[model samples]
Target chain A: MFLWIIQRDLLLAMRRRADVLTTLFFFIIVVSLFPLGVGPEMNMLRTMAPGVVWVAALLASMLSLGRMFSSDHADGTLEQMLLSPQSLSLLVLGKALAHWLVTGVPLVLMAPVLGIQYDLSTDALLVLTASLLLGTPVLSLIGAIGAALTLGLRGGGVLVSLLVLPLYIPVLIFGAGAVEASAAGLGAGAHMSLLGAFLLASLVLAPWTAAVSLRISME
Target chain B: MAINWFKYSSPASFYSLAGKMIPFFSVAAAVLFVVGLYIGFFVAPTDFQQGEAYRIIFIHVPAAWLSMFLYVIMAMWSGIGLAFNTRLSSMVATAIAPTGAMFTFLALWTGALWGKPMWGTWWVWDARLTSELILLFLYIGFMSLQAAIDDPRRADKAGAMIALVGVVNVPIIYFSVKWWNTLHQGASVSLTQSPKMASTMLTGMLIMSLACWMYAIAVILIRTRAIILERERHTVWVGQLQEATQ
Candidate 1:
């Protein structure tokens, strides 16, 4: 049942290619704007690269969070999903997993291109990709709770960022730290492992909370 | 006889109870602050190394301590609201927000003041400072989330979930100094250790901390009363309470 739900979400998302492309485009544009704003000195860009990329990714992921559950809730599909024999927890987890695939994986894949603008080294690019792979799932999982909480509300966009950004601190710290470490020729394995532990913990915790929030908002 | 636990859980009863306790706590807090400040500022001996500049520790350490302490208390009240459907629990959580934010601001402000003298700079990207800044953002986020929503009940539930999630970040903030190779120093006073400083200094710091604790409780009680009244405005008790106050 979980697999079917995941597949269904992916198919639905694929049908809306413009939405996915637009989000990715926004991510790229925001990242590119940072170097232009901060000046194009290679050394300066290298120094600030990890933070700029991580923040842009955070904002882009947050922009995508509001759409995660809103359309379904609005169309009554979420109600039908809730009433289905499949546990709401699994449904929530499945949707979160699918959202991570669509939103997070693209960010991971696009890191190399963005890294080039920051003048990040090949090694730094690899570490940046690895950190994003581990970190963005955490973002999606945590973002799921925010989305569920604000599912039907007006100005949910602003409220979702306010609620979720604090929770993103650990991910931001470790993710940016990993890239910076690799850039400095230090081993980033420990930082990457911490990011993985954080991701695993959030994966286990966020869906249950998201399910509860969904039920409350639905009520 | 069975205690009618649910009776005081009512917003009206809790409002009156909070109102009654506020004056007592305020007086206690005032007394403690006067005595503590006398000991801390006037009588406490100067630091052997950092000199008189260490006087900021009296406020800095206590404010930092309370910032973390209040986040935990907020989470506890939020959990109670979620688990048992208690009427006053969310109000209690709501009441703690401003006080918690104030403590966080105090921590940062005094930290900067202390850092300027000690580190020779007003700011550094130390792990502890960064995490505390995040803590401030978390408190602001909770308050903003509650305010943005129109329906009080839905707002409470949403704020509760955010609070619960944000609680995970508090321990990270507390331990960031220990976890990373950072510029910030570790705790001078910890739960499992003997005092690292002189007995007099430790006494002064602890007393100031106690004063901060009492002040936090008093402020939260006063704020909780306001929350209960605002939330229960349509209720007869609120009308009567307003009439009495007027």
Candidate 2:
């Protein structure tokens, strides 16, 4: 049942390819704008590379988060899901998983392009991809809680960012730190482990919280 | 004796109860502040290392302590609201947030003012400072989420969730100094150990911290009363209470 829900969300997301493409485009444009705004010096871009990418990823994930539960709730699908025999927690998790697949995975895959644009080293590129791979899923999971809480609200986009950004701080610190550590040829393992622990913790915690939020918002 | 758990849990009951308690707390807070300031500023011995500049700790440490202490209280109220579905619990949580945020700003502001002399820079990405900055953001996020939702019940629930999720960050911030070899100093007044400072300095800091706590209670009680009235405007008690006030 959970797999079916995941498949359904994936198919729905694929059908709205424009939404996916627009989000990705926004990610790229926002990232590109950072270097332009900060100046095009390779040395400066390299120093700022980890932060710029992480910030872009954070913003992009937030842009996609409002759609996570909002569209489903809007179309009455969320109500049907809640009323279904399948547990709401599992259903919400499935939706969040699909969201990570669509939004976060693409960002991870596209990191090399972003890395090259920012003149990141080979080591930095590897670390950036690794951090994003571990980090962005946590963003999707945690953001789901915010998205669910603001499911039916106007100005949810602004509220969602406000609510979620603080939660994103540890991820931002660790993700960027991991890449910077690797770029400096230091061991990035501790940073990566912390990110993994964070992801694991958020995965365990966010789904139930999201389910409760959905119930609250729907009520 | 069974605790009157539900007695003060109702918004109407808490509203009236809070009103009765505010004056006492306000007076206590004012008295403590005057005494603590006198001791902290004039009576406490000068630090051999930091000299008069170290006097800022009287405000900085207390503000930082209250900021974290209030967040825990806020999250506890939020947790109660989420777990037990109490309207007053969430209202209390909402009432505590702005003050928590304000103290966080005060802590950071005073820390910056203190740091300029000690650390020789206004800001550094030092672990403690960074985590405190994140703490400020967390408070703002909680406030913004609550304000954005039009429905009070929904907003309370949403804010509770954010508060709960953000609570996990609090411990991380507290321990970040220890967990990583960061620039922030380890705790000087931990419960596990005798305080590292002189007795007079400790006395002054403790008095100031208590003053801050009393002030927080007074402010939150006052704010919660306002929140209860605003939220329960349609309730009979609110109308009667408004009439009484007028």
lDDT of model 2 at residue A154?
A: 76
**Can you tell me which runs of candidate 1 are displaced by over 4 Å?**
B1-7, B242-245
Question: What tens-digit string does per-residue lDDT give for candidate 1 at B121-165?
Answer: 999988899989988999998898888878888888888988898
lDDT of each: 0.88, 0.89
Q: After superposition, how far is residue A95 of candidate 1 from its true place, in Å?
A: 1.6
Q: Could you give candidate 2's per-residue lDDT for residues B1-246 as a string of tens digits?
A: 988878988887777778889999999999999999999988999999988998998888999988898999999999999888899999999999999999999999998998898889898898888889888998998898888888888888888888887887778778888987876677778888888999999889999999999999999998988888788888777777655469
- On the 0 to 100 scale, the lDDT of residue B149 in model 2 is 85
| Worst-scoring 10-residue span by lDDT in model 2 chain A | A150-159
RMSD to truth, every model: 1.8, 1.7
> What share of the reference contacts is kept in model 1?
0.70
Q: Model 2 clash pairs?
A: none
Model 2 chain B poorest ten-residue lDDT run: B236-245
lDDT of 2 by residue, A30-116 (tens): 999987787889998998989999999999999999889877777898899888888788888898899999999889999889999
Whole-model alpha-carbon lDDT for candidate 1: 0.88
